[model samples]
Target: METQKINVAAILVVALTGIIVTVLAASLLMAYQRVPNYGYVKSVGVGVYWDQACTENVTSIDWGILEPGSNRTQVIWIKNTGNTQVVLNMTTGNWTTPEAENYISLTWNREGQILNANQSISATLTLSVSTTITETDIVEFSFDMIITGTEQES
Candidate 1:
């Protein structure tokens, strides 16, 4: 009779342990199953920047009469007229004229810089000429630019 009682007690303990483990596993499974339904919250904002129209405001400079064998500097203004800040990016293209065929160059300021809205920045470029550039003669300068918007979550 004592042996029978001991066996019954052991069986009860084993059954309770199995039931607890099963319940825990089922709870974990349900939690994982519902994870896909959870939604995420994000904040957003609006941004504006200079468009192509801003190019019209660019300042063009001409070094009228630098003496022969002298270097001259020309400063140009770039303005940002948008709601957001922008950085100036300059790109150069090749050009050829009757007098000069292989002496054109262009450059830009540091990359990834910022320009606040309605702010203006200037760049000074130097050119070395073998002969004086006549006031009546024109030297054409052109470049491409872009105004990118700030990144904001939606």
Candidate 2:
């Protein structure tokens, strides 16, 4: 009879421990399920817009005629369309014609500069042909200007 009582007490203790462990696990799960809301929207915005004659669909600049020993300049405006400030990096690709590449010179005023939100910067591009270009030589060529913007660091 004493042994039977001891067995029943041990069983009750085991049952109590199981119930405590289950309750603790359930409480922990409930705590994790409730997510705190800070009411803040998270986003990272980086964008730029070119105000040149070329649009998103059209990417070309026309220099009427390529004359030897002459320089042609075009002004392009860049605007920051993002919510934050950014620094721009500009680069140009190779000319379409390999033969005219050496004779043609391209330059921009603003290569690496900082711009604020909704701010505008004017970049002047000068295309000059060397005097060595002859009348017999074909000088029609085109190049690409790539502008990239990076978020400013704090």
Candidate 3:
């Protein structure tokens, strides 16, 4: 009976220590700061809209406050306004600061997706900033997100 009591005490001590270590690790992980950035949005061959109706154009993307090594996603609609089927292509250019282009990247869920004429598709746009961006030279930047669509010839 006494041996069992000692074993129980040892297990309880180990569990309590483990819980304390876990709580401390979580607290440390949550003690980081967030960085902020912003950029402009534009479209070319296709319409980037906030609504499926394609009336509310997505003029800009506010990444808001961000953390290093973190990614932000925005959902928008792309409309094929041309008369023929088109494959959507997205590109970024005209960055306000050259360093911004090197540290920040833009991507979409759909790559080389074909859209029928007058059809709209919801797309998730992701903006990622490198965790190695230690340089404080850039707090904000602007860029043109040209979402061009290539016409598929029959």
**TM-scores, one per candidate:** 0.36, 0.62, 0.68
Report the Cα RMSD per candidate. 10.7, 5.5, 24.1
Instruction: Give the count of colliding residue pairs in each prediction.
Output: 0, 0, 0
Mind sharing the TM-score for model 1? 0.36
C-alpha RMSD of candidate 3? 24.1
Q: On a 0 to 1 TM-score scale, where does candidate 2 land against the true structure?
A: 0.62
Could you arrange the candidates by TM-score from highest to lowest?
Answer: 3, 2, 1
Comparing 1 and 3 by TM-score, which wins?
3
lDDT of 3 by residue, 7-101 (tens): 99999999999999999999888867789989744333678899988999998888898777889999999998767788888999999897888
Report lDDT (Cα) of residue 135, candidate 1: 36
The ten-residue window of minimal lDDT in model 3 covers 39-48
Q: Candidate 2 on 1-154: residue-level lDDT in tens?
A: 9999999999999999999999999988884456777764423333333454324322567788977999999877777667667787766677677677678877777666887876766778888888887844655877776776677786
Candidate 1 displacement at residue 146 in angstroms: 9.7
In candidate 2, stretches whose alpha carbon ends up further than 4 angstroms from where it belongs are 1-25, 28-58, 135-138
lDDT of 1 by residue, 35-115 (tens): 456654432221222233335443334456555456676555555545555544444334335343233343334344466
**TM-score of model 3 (CA atoms):** 0.68
